[model samples]
Target: MDDPTPEVADQEAPSSGIAKAQPEVGPPLVEMVNVWKRFGQGAGETVALAGVDLAIQPGEFVTLIGPSGCGKSTLFNMIAGLTDTDSDGSVVFKNKPQRDGELLGKVSFMPQKDLLFAWRTVLDNATLALEIEGVPRAKARARAEAMFPEFGLAGFEKHYPHQLSGGMRQRVALMRTFLFERELMLLDEPFGALDALTRAMMQRWLLEIWEKHRRTVLFITHDIDEAIFLGDKVVVMTARPGRIKTVETIDLPRPRGAEVITSPEFIEIKRRLLGIVEEESLKSFASAGAS
Candidate 1:
C-alpha cells in the first residue's frame, strides 16, 4: 500500500491562519479538575496522578507530552471515562460532570497500537466500530468503503493486517477511529510505530484530516517536535503522580507542512518545551531510581 501523501492544497489559506494564542479559551469541551489517581490503598500503592487540571476547547488540537512514568495514559483513561478520578476530583465533558463509564464508546480512542485483527479484512476492521454501534454490516462496510481513498486504502480493502506496512496499518486504524465519529478524539501515539519518513507523512495527513473533519483532538506523544508540530497547545505533565506542569500554546501558521518544523517560530516553541520535558523526564528517572 502506498503511503498517504495527499498534497493538501492551501486553498483556504485565510481560514487556515494559525489560531490566535488564547490558552483555554471559552467553554471547555472537556474539563478535569484536581484529578487524582492511586492504584492501591496500601503502602505499595502507586500515585499515578495528582491535582491535575485540564480544559480543552471545542475543535482544538491539543497534544500532550511528558516523562515515561508521567501518567499520560492514565489521564487518557480517566478522560475516556474507562476509569474515574479519585473521590476529590471531577471529570466533566460537554458541560456535564461524567459519572463512571459514561465516556466509554462516547469519544473515539486510538491507543498506542493499531490493534487490527489479522483475521479481518481492512474494510472489516475499519467498519468494526459502526458494526458494533448497531449499524448493519453491509451499511457499515459501505460507509468505510466510501472513505477508503480518502484514508489511503482504496484498493486494499480485501487485504488483512499482515498484508500491510506499518504506516498502512496505522492509517486503517485511524480510518476506524474517524468512522466512529465522536466529537472528541483521543489519539495515543497513532504513528509511533512508523519510521521517521512515514511518521512525517502520517502527521501531514492527520492535519489535513483534522482540518476537513474539525474534531477536537487530544493526542499524546513523547516527542517534543511531534507535540509542538501537531498541537494548538502542548500540555506537559510533571513526573509520576503527575500534575499539569505547563500548557504552552503553539501560535504558528496552520496548514503546517514539514517546513514549519524548522521555522524560527516552531523552534522557539520546541525550545521552550524541551526545557520542560527534559526537567520532567529527569524527575521521572530520579523518582523511579528512588523506588
Candidate 2:
C-alpha cells in the first residue's frame, strides 16, 4: 500500500469533516383558506371580508396592509377567533382547523396601544398574563423578573405605567405578551402610537427579539415602509369588503439593519408598495365620500 496523493486526500476531507444537510422545514403554522366574514344583522349586513386566503409559515414574519375599511383588522379578528368566518373556508393551526379559543393560551396579541395596567408596576404588568392563566404567583414573578434585564426594563420594573415613556410602556406590553408560552403572535399596529424616531427604534428592537426567538408572527401595519422592512411577505388587500389583492415576497437579506432601507432594492420595493397602497387608499376614500 502507498500513501494517498494530495488530490485523493482533498476528496476524502469533506467526507470525514462535513455533516449531512438537514431536511427542509415543514408547512405553515397558520392557514386561512377562503375565509369570509360579515358584520351587522338582517338587511343591514356589511361584509368585512370576502373569500380571503392567507398562510403564515413557522418563524416567518408577515404583514397585512390595506386601505381603511378593507377589513385588515377584521381578517385578523377571524384568525384570533374573535369573529366568525361565514363562508366555506377555515383557519388552521398546526394543520388542524382552528376552533374558538383553540389558541387562547398559545397565542399572544398586542394591540395599537400599550394596554398596560395603570395600577400595576411594570414587572407585575408584564406578568399579568401568566397570573390570569392560573400560573402560581411566585413562578410568574420569577419569569417576569428574569426577562427584565433582557427586555430593557431592568431598573424600571417597579415603575407604574405613568412613569414610563411611550416606548418603554410598549416594551413592557410586549414583554407581558411573551411572558407565557406563546408560539404565534398577532400584532395590530403595535407601534402605530409611537413617534417616528421611537417607532423606528422599536422596529429594530422587535426584529432583534424575533431573530432570537423565531416566533411565527403576523403583524398588521398601515405603514407600507414598516410592512416592507419587517415582513417576510407583505400581503396587500383590496379596498372595501377586503380581499387579498397581492402578496409580495420580500427577498431582502436576513439580519436586516436600518441601512438596508436605503438600498436600491429596498427603495424600489417601498415605491411599488406605496403605489399599491395609495391607489387603494384613494379608492376607499372616494367610495366613502360618495356614499
Candidate 3:
C-alpha cells in the first residue's frame, strides 16, 4: 500500500495567524459524486442522502457534523461499503468505483459504542480483528500487547472491559481499530458518551495518536467544538435528505492545546459553524413536528 501521508505545500499564514492545508496534487483517496440514498417507495418513501458530493484526501482528519436524522450514519455505511449508493451516483475509492460490500475490510470502522466484549481480556479484545483475519492468536496477542502502553492500557492487559473505566474502554476499542491497519478509518462519535473532561482528554490523546499514524480519518460528531478542534476540514450536512451544506477548512495550528479553543480564530470559526448547524437543527425540528 502507498504511504497515506499527504505532501503539503508551503503557504503564507492568514492574518488570523492560522495556517490551512493547501490542495494536494493527487486524486482523492475517496470521492463520492452526486451520491443519493433512499428507502421504501411511494408515500412511505424517504430520502436519506441527496446528491452528496465529498472527497477525502489522504492523511486528512475530516470531521462531519449535522442535525439528527441527517443521514450521517448512512453516509458512513456507504463509505465503509456496508451499503450501496443509488444508481444515479457513484462512490469512488482510490479512484475506482465501489459496489456494495466491496469496501469492506478496506476501511477500519469504529461506531459510537465501544462494543468491547466483557468475556475477553483487554489484550485479547484488541487483537480480535487480527485474529479474525486468520493471524495466529499468539502473533496477534504479541502485536496487541506491544501497543498497550501507547494506548494507555499498560498493566491492564489481563483486565476485561467491565474492569476498566469508560475512557479506558474507548482506548481499547480504538487500539483494536488501529491494529486492524487500514488506509482509512471511519469513526462515528467515538467520544460522544464520555463526560466533558474525559472527552476533552480523549480528543487530545486521539490527535497525538493520529499525528503518529497519519491514517486518513473521517469522523462524525454532533459537537461543533469537537469537529473544529479535531478536523483538517469540518463538513456540515443539511437537514433530512442530507447534503453537504458547507465544508470549512480548519486553519488552526496542530499539536493544538486546549487553550487554542479560546483563540480568536477558533471562536470565529465556531460562531460561523454554530449558525449553520443551528439553522439546520431548526429545520429538522420543524419537519419532525409536522410529521
Candidate 4:
C-alpha cells in the first residue's frame, strides 16, 4: 500500500532581516499520521489523542504547548517509543513505520525532573547513560568531564546532586541527555521547575548548546514565551482528545537574545498564539467542569 503521510515542503524564508535558517529539503525526521490513542474501554474509556498529525524536519527545534490534560505528555511518550499509538494510526521515523518500543534507544529523552541520583557525583550522573551503554566507566567519565566546562559545571564535578542548585542539577541532567548521542531529542519541560530568572538563563544556555550541536529537538512546554523563544516552529495542541491546533513558524531569527521577546514581530506572533491557546484553555476548563 502507498504511504498516506503528506510530505512537508521546505518553508520559505520570511522577509524579515533576521529570519531563521531554512530546513534542508528532505523527508521529515519524524512524522505522525492520523494518530489516535485511547485508554480503557467502554464507559470509562478516555481518548487522549485523536487524529494527531505532525511532521518534524531534521535539525529543527519544535516546541509544543497546550492546556493541561491536553495529551502533550502522551504525545511525547509516543515519540519516545515508551508508548505506542492505537491501531488506527502509525508513527513513521525517517520514513519507516515504527512498531512499539522501536524508537526507545533511537531518541534521547529527558523528563521534567532532573532525576539525578543523590548518591552519585555530578560527573557520574552526567555519564550515567554512557556507562549504561557499556562505554567503559573511565571513557564515559572522560567524555563527560570534557563537556562540564561547556555546560557550566566545570568545577562542580565532584559534588553530589544534593550539593548543586536546581538549575545546576538540570544542566547536569541535560548534559547526560546530550551524551546519549541520539539524532532526535525529546525534552518534556526540562526547565519547568526553575525560578524565572534561572529559567531564562537556562533558555539562553540551551539555545547556545542547541545551535552548536543542531540536534533535532521536540520540546514540550506550558510557558508560551519559552515555546516562542526556543523553537523554529511552535506547535499548539487543542484541548482534550488533543490534536495539533496550529504550527506557527517562528520567524524571529537566530541567536535570539532577551531583547527579541519585546520586539514587535515577537509580540505579534505571541498575540496570535495567545488567542488560540486561550480559546483551547477555555474549552479544557469547560470540559473539566462538566465531567
What are the runs in model 1 whose C-alpha is more than 4 Å off? 1-23
Question: Worst ten-residue run, lDDT, model 4?
Answer: 13-22
> What lDDT would each prediction earn against the true structure?
0.85, 0.80, 0.89, 0.89
Span of 10 residues, lowest total lDDT, candidate 2: 1-10
For candidate 4, the lDDT comes to 0.89
Please give, for residues 1-291, the per-residue lDDT of candidate 1 as tens digits: 111121211223434211122345588999886677888756777888776778999999999988897899999998887898777678889899887788888899999999999899999999999999999999999999999999888899999999999999999999999999999999998888789999999999999999999999999998899998899888888787677777787898899999999999988888888987887788778877888
lDDT of 4 by residue, 239-261 (tens): 97787777888998899999999
Candidate 4 residue spans exceeding 4 A from truth: 1-24
The per-residue C-alpha lDDT of model 2 at residue 250 equals 93
lDDT, candidate 3, 6-60, per-residue tens: 2212235222212233345689999987788889877788989877778899999
The parts of candidate 3 lying over 4 Å away from their true place are 1-24
Count of backbone collisions in candidate 4: 0
Between prediction 1 and prediction 4, the one with superior lDDT is 4
Each model's RMSD to truth, in Å? Answer: 10.3, 14.1, 7.5, 5.7
* Per-residue C-alpha lDDT of model 2 across residues 176-234, encoded as one tens digit per residue: 88776678898999899899999999999999988988988899999988998999988
Residue pairs whose backbone atoms clash in candidate 2: none
Residue 29 local lDDT, model 4: 92
Task: Kindly indicate the candidate among 1 and 2 with the higher TM-score.
Answer: 1
Task: Report the alpha-carbon TM-score of model 4 versus the true structure.
Answer: 0.92
For model 1, state the Cα shift of residue 102 in Å.
0.9
Q: Who is ahead in lDDT, 1 or 3?
A: 3
